[model samples]
Target: MMVSYHHKNSGQFEDICVADLDYAFTNVTLPDREGRWCVGVAEGKIVEIVEGDRLNAQHVWHLDGKLLTPGLVDAHTHIDKAFTAESLGDVFAQSGLASAIQAVRHLKSQFTIADIKQRATQALQWSIAAGTTAIRTNVEADAFVELRAVEGLLDVQRSLSDQIDIQLVAFPQEGWFAIPETLESGASTYVEQALQHGIKVIGGNVNQGLWSSNPEAQVDALFDLALRYNCDLDLHLDNWDSAEAFTLPYVAQKTIEHHYQGRVAVSHIASLIHVSDSQAQVAIELLKQAEISVTVLPTRIKLTRVAELLEAGLNVVCGTDNLRDPFIRYGDADLLKALFLLAQLTGYMANRDLERLWQTISNNAAKMLRLPYGINVGNLADLVVFDAYSIPEAILHQATRLAVFKSGKLVAGTMQDQVLSLHKPDFMSPRRWT
Candidate 1:
């Protein structure tokens, strides 16, 4: 059977014939399909996904019974400050969020355009090599770094457009109005400059204003900017340990007030884990009502009640928020590692739980970004093939990504070799070899 399909790549759509596929992946494991399946790609879009060994294409990739999934999406990250651990030195060794923020602010004061570009581009390459096809990174826009951070990331976004989709958020890490200079100098003006430089999202940390006279006003201000600029809102909400600092409900209320239901996302609401059950339930209900999504960075915090958030019917996703930065001293830009940490932190060890965790970094994150690729017919051909049997195994072992495809084009591939020798020293061996 032949079918005509519309192929879209890099926002350009064209009609193509499914029978003349440019490439096909055979003997791959697909969800909700029986036996080994085949995925046919033409003009950088998936044309046919059928249950069979159909490999009659110009190019064929034999999966050898490996797991194939939609390309990974990093819903939340900080690319501007990535890979700055060594430069920050031992000042952040035993620090919490507050001290880390201070150290990063100091570092940002010394940021040069070339330095930011080099570090951020390296991070993007590492992420792409690790099978991330899309990333929504928060670029800081404070009085220190100003618009240079946005410029650095914009360059990376343009350079990697074909290999990965990069969405930049004009993030005011210090705060919107809490910092006197930020407010006096027009913080919105800085964010506006970032938007003018091609940022598609606006980010703020409402918790920075919790001690202020009116924190709700700060949330309202960010929502107003989002509405005015016609960009999505991704806020850093309530990331502390005190339950009293939780402001997710307020963010949700503002989302409803602005009628910005699905366009809002709140990241690192770690305080929710410390709040009372009743309190958390109220916030979750409000989040569900507003349709605001959540992104959890399990490595950056002590704990996150991801299972509860998922059970509450909220669109919960996960990301590698920081990679060796002042905020988080460790990360390899690996989403699988983040997933493993999330499972261990939440004690979600069941098969279903692991599967859900996979979705957190893949499908759920994709939904938040509104990306146009998945394991389905008539979608963009962005996928990752892993050297694992099932989702549980993939999460447990953190298997190597055999291949990664962006718009049906091979971008990264890995082949590893290992050799182990079994030998004992004469002091410990019962029988020594002569």
Candidate 2:
């Protein structure tokens, strides 16, 4: 089928051809549909979605029997530190978080703009090939590294602007007030410089300043900067394994006090699992009232009560916090792998449970990041087509993507086969082939 529409860029009428839209999966939760469906694209936006057999257009793609869904969105990641496992040797084996922080600080000292850009671009390519269309990464900005991470990510963002959407958070891994240089130079100045360099979000580590004289003061200062700069907040709070480390309630209170509801997100609050059930409920209520979202990193921490958090009406999302860095030694820039691990850790085995888990990496993460693409008409044509029959089968097999589209244009996919063939005697035991 072919459809005619005006192209947004050329200011001219054009015809788009779509064929065999039958066997399409409209929604992840809905059952498959057999009726033919055609999607019309104009000016990089989905103009119309038709459910009929007779349609016409200039370009036609017959999916045959592929499963289509909204492209994956990674709500949280550390792209700057990706693929650095080989350099650390055995340091990560005996070191804790504190030691890891020190090691990262050392690594940052030697970071040049070219080096950072090369590594970050490599990570983005891996993500794009994995069917991820949008990513929100936290880049470090402190006295040691200054704006190196921010500048490098901005470069990568420009280079891949046509392939994927990248949102960078100017993160002060060291506390805003704990470091003497930051205090002397004024933390706002550092963050403002990062914002000027194209950072869209602001991030902080609440636990970094908790040991200082007054932790609330640091929190207030960070929130004030975010409000003043008109940037969203994504803070790392209460990451300890102790029950008494309760910064979530205070963060919630501050969110309401500053009128920053729905604009604030807290990550790695693993201590919520250690608190008593009643206390945890109270904290969850506070988070709900404040309209604050949560990002859980299952690989970095062991106790993340994802099931309970979801039941409390909180917008719980998942992220690959670190990849082959000091914080974590393993990650392949794949959010589906993260979702699978999260399901196993949280004991979500049922079909319905798996559907909900899928939402965390796709729709839920997209909403939190304020992206425009999804499985709907009149949205950006960013989507992924999988070579599977059902959502469950896709998750179970984790097969390679058939096609990845960004703004109605093909970006990444596997088109050629790479199989090796060798002959062997049939009498040989198959079990001993290895």
Candidate 3:
């Protein structure tokens, strides 16, 4: 959309600026701001954000005093295994994470590229409707699946590039070195093969299905692949409830040793909560120094040390880990719901805490994925308009997303009509008791 603007001059007219914006959002309340503002977008980038509804463009959306924020980011998910819980049955639900991991094997072997795309597309649609525009999904990349998950998710990534940014992590769910048959054949490991096949992130699971007695060796091998591929590392460390399952400190140490600081993310470090406070602090310090991103799957783990991590001024984000899968068997892929649950679990009731916690799903996740995100000038116009006036209000209620904008285009939204109040408070009328 384009808008023609005329410049006023002394006695003569001049075309100082054309003001060819693709679209503009007016009458929207920005986070922490007092008054309504207008955001102008041109060529898929925000061009201006000025107070008051003065932006003139060919297409203008009046948000009706709703809140506007950067699009939500779901930093961690399992799209390859989404929506397969009932087939696997409720047995894993009773047994726990390990059993769930084992139960999914039967389903994983049957996953075709088309099947993965179909399930992933459904999950992505739910997430998009929930205002998430960026996601990072861990795709299984061991010899058993033989890069089928990677291949399938890459297809989904390409197909949904316009709606959402899908970052694929070549995840060796069954340990990078567990499958001897693939190694005996002298072929490259599936993780490396996946990276070569266009996955820019490497994933490791040390606590689950890891055949290697040397957990540190898996970490080393993952780092080797990450360095070899020149990609980011997202590893699952300390995922269980026991303090003895601790591997986060080692991962942090290796992150710094390999100079992978600020390029590595560790998910589900639940052991941090079980360890002594001093020990947890020591690990947190290493994480801070390494500049590692910590992602907690609030739906999957109850004790992830998110409060302490956030207090340490570390980069902490949250994700919807599994949707109707054996691992979780719940969640609608709504990241706001996950963040709300996180806020409640962490007792983040204060206004400041709630506002800051919103970053976990938006800015912090974007930082983890290294995306240029925000409702700032010159940044991609990926934003969500909420049916509320404040961050805390939105999180507290999981407010409806009025509209979602990706690259300055309207992609998904609940175009509900403006709410009407049929009954008015009759203050002048006497109360029955009175």
Of the candidates shown, which would achieve the greatest TM-score relative to the real structure? 1
Model 1 residue 406 CA deviation in Å: 0.6
What's every prediction's RMSD, in angstroms?
6.3, 6.3, 6.2
Better of 2 and 3 by lDDT: 3
Clashes of each: 0, 11, 0
Q: Candidate 3: which stretches are off by over 4 Å?
A: 1-18, 32-34, 93-102, 179-188, 208-212, 414-434
- lDDT score, candidate 1, position 163: 94
* Alpha-carbon lDDT, every model: 0.79, 0.73, 0.80
Error of 2 at 33 (Å): 7.6
Worst 10 residues of 3 by lDDT: 425-434
- Put down candidate 2 lDDT per residue, 1-434, tens digits, no spaces: 55555554567765544442222222222113444455555556666566642344455555433456778899999998787777775575679655765676788878888888998999888898889999999898876778888888898999999999999998877666644533322345667789887787988777632345255666788788887888899988888788766688888999999888988988988788888989889989999999888998877758467898888868888887788876677888888788878888888877678778778888778878877656564567787777554565566557567768788777898432222111224443222211
* Candidate 3 global TM-score: 0.88
